[model samples]
Target: MDPGSKLPLSPHIQIYRLPLTALLSVVHRATGVALALGAVLLVWILALAANSAEAYGQLYPHLASWYGQIFLLGLIFSLYLHFCNGIRHLFWDIGMGFDLEIVHRTAKFAIFAAIVLTVATWAIAANLEL
Candidate 1:
């Protein structure tokens, strides 16, 4: 409380880099939110299909455009990442994989698995179209 003495200041984000687990934790929450938002897109697509062919036709062109493809890809990746991270959390809920090393390994695996699953889903869908 003395004006003459300065208290130790906590490290700012610029000064302190987050650990991998901490960064992944943040991404996990972000992806969760992204997936929730993506559900709205899903509903819109379904509603368009249910209404009429003309209504669905209106949506198809936008979805087939490059920007729309990019948005769809991001949404797909977010869905996989959120699903993978949720499984990681389920293990934690059961008091498993608590070791620091195990935690780090699983964090890496979750990200890797999500990327793999996302790519595989796209590849399979593409093949189906052919």
Candidate 2:
């Protein structure tokens, strides 16, 4: 390495904008992490179930509050996103859908589907709860 030679800079995140495929890949990983956290919440709910109905009854309303419901809805969105992305990956494993057009199109579809499914699921659940 010569001191006079400048090092080449790859477009770092601060400099380079990520494309839809790259952004969705990052979001997929983030959703995986969020799903783990959601799993922990489920475990807590399970513990309550195992302990006593009285225990869950005391906690249900708080879990039904605005923030809790928002978190649950976010969890649902993550589940759908992750599921869809996993299917995308399976297609990749089969050596399919690597074209830029397909990648971007599927990425957009996954995001849209996740939102739609989450909202639809919550709407149905709310109706049933009533």
Candidate 3:
């Protein structure tokens, strides 16, 4: 091979079928990014809450809108997923739940827990009129 020439690269998921783990890995990172952004938003919310009622009033209406609610809901789900998966990773780091069956079961459990937590959060928020 010429020094300037690159070796042929094997085709990836775009050409071959990708596995669940591959897709889950991508989603995990994506959710992490979403959670980071959500954390920034959470800080803003806290700042607003700490400020005067007038300041919160100014921000609240925007946050109460449909678009804002949707964004918040997305953030909530992302945070839940990231949190659950983070715990799963901690368990893996401790040398537990590494078996193929256990890994699959844990992945499924994390997903279910995330959904449940997200929905429960929304329910409480609605009940509190927040």
Candidate 4:
């Protein structure tokens, strides 16, 4: 190695076009982490509810606010995505969906199912008083 030679740089995300399965794997892990974080919010709400109705009432308005709604939406999507991807992984454990085409199709379907299920869940919740 020459002392004056430029160091070789390793390939990075910018240098690679990740396949759909790779990207979805990343998203699945990310959503799993996000859901863990979201659990804190759920716990906070539960604690407030358990303490007193008055305390819960005070926090409820903020949760019902626009920013809160966005957070809930993100949480709901994360839940759905993680759940669907988990089912995908389960099928893999059962020795199914191993083909490259099947993998790609299932990844895409997971995303679509998450979106549809999240919307459906919110729709049903919206109609109820809770």
Output the lDDT of residue 85, model 1: 83
Listed per model in order, the count of residue pairs whose N, CA or C atoms clash below 3 Å is 0, 0, 0, 0
Across 1-130, the per-residue lDDT of candidate 2 in tens digits comes to 7878788767776989999888889988999999998889889999998999999898899879999888787889899999888899999999999998998998888888888888888899999978
Go through the candidates in order and give the C-alpha RMSD of each one to the true structure: 1.8, 1.9, 3.6, 3.2
Residues forming the 10-long window of minimal summed lDDT in candidate 2:
4-13
* C-alpha root-mean-square deviation, candidate 1: 1.8
- TM-score winner between 3 and 4, please give it: 4
Q: How close to the true structure is residue 71 of candidate 3, measured as C-alpha lDDT?
A: 86
Worst ten in a row by lDDT for model 3: 16-25
Q: Clash pairs of candidate 3?
A: none
TM-score of 2: 0.89
Residue-wise C-alpha lDDT for candidate 4, range 7-115, written one tens digit per residue: 8755567988898899889988999999998998899989999999999999999879999899899999999999999999999999999999999999999999999
Between candidates 2 and 4, the one scoring higher on TM-score is: 2
lDDT of 1 by residue, 66-124 (tens): 99889888999988888998899999999999999999999999989999999999999
Higher-scoring candidate on TM-score, 1 or 2? 1
- Alpha-carbon lDDT of model 4: 0.92
Backbone clash total for model 3 is 0
Pairs in steric clash, model 4 = none
Residue pairs in clash, model 1: none
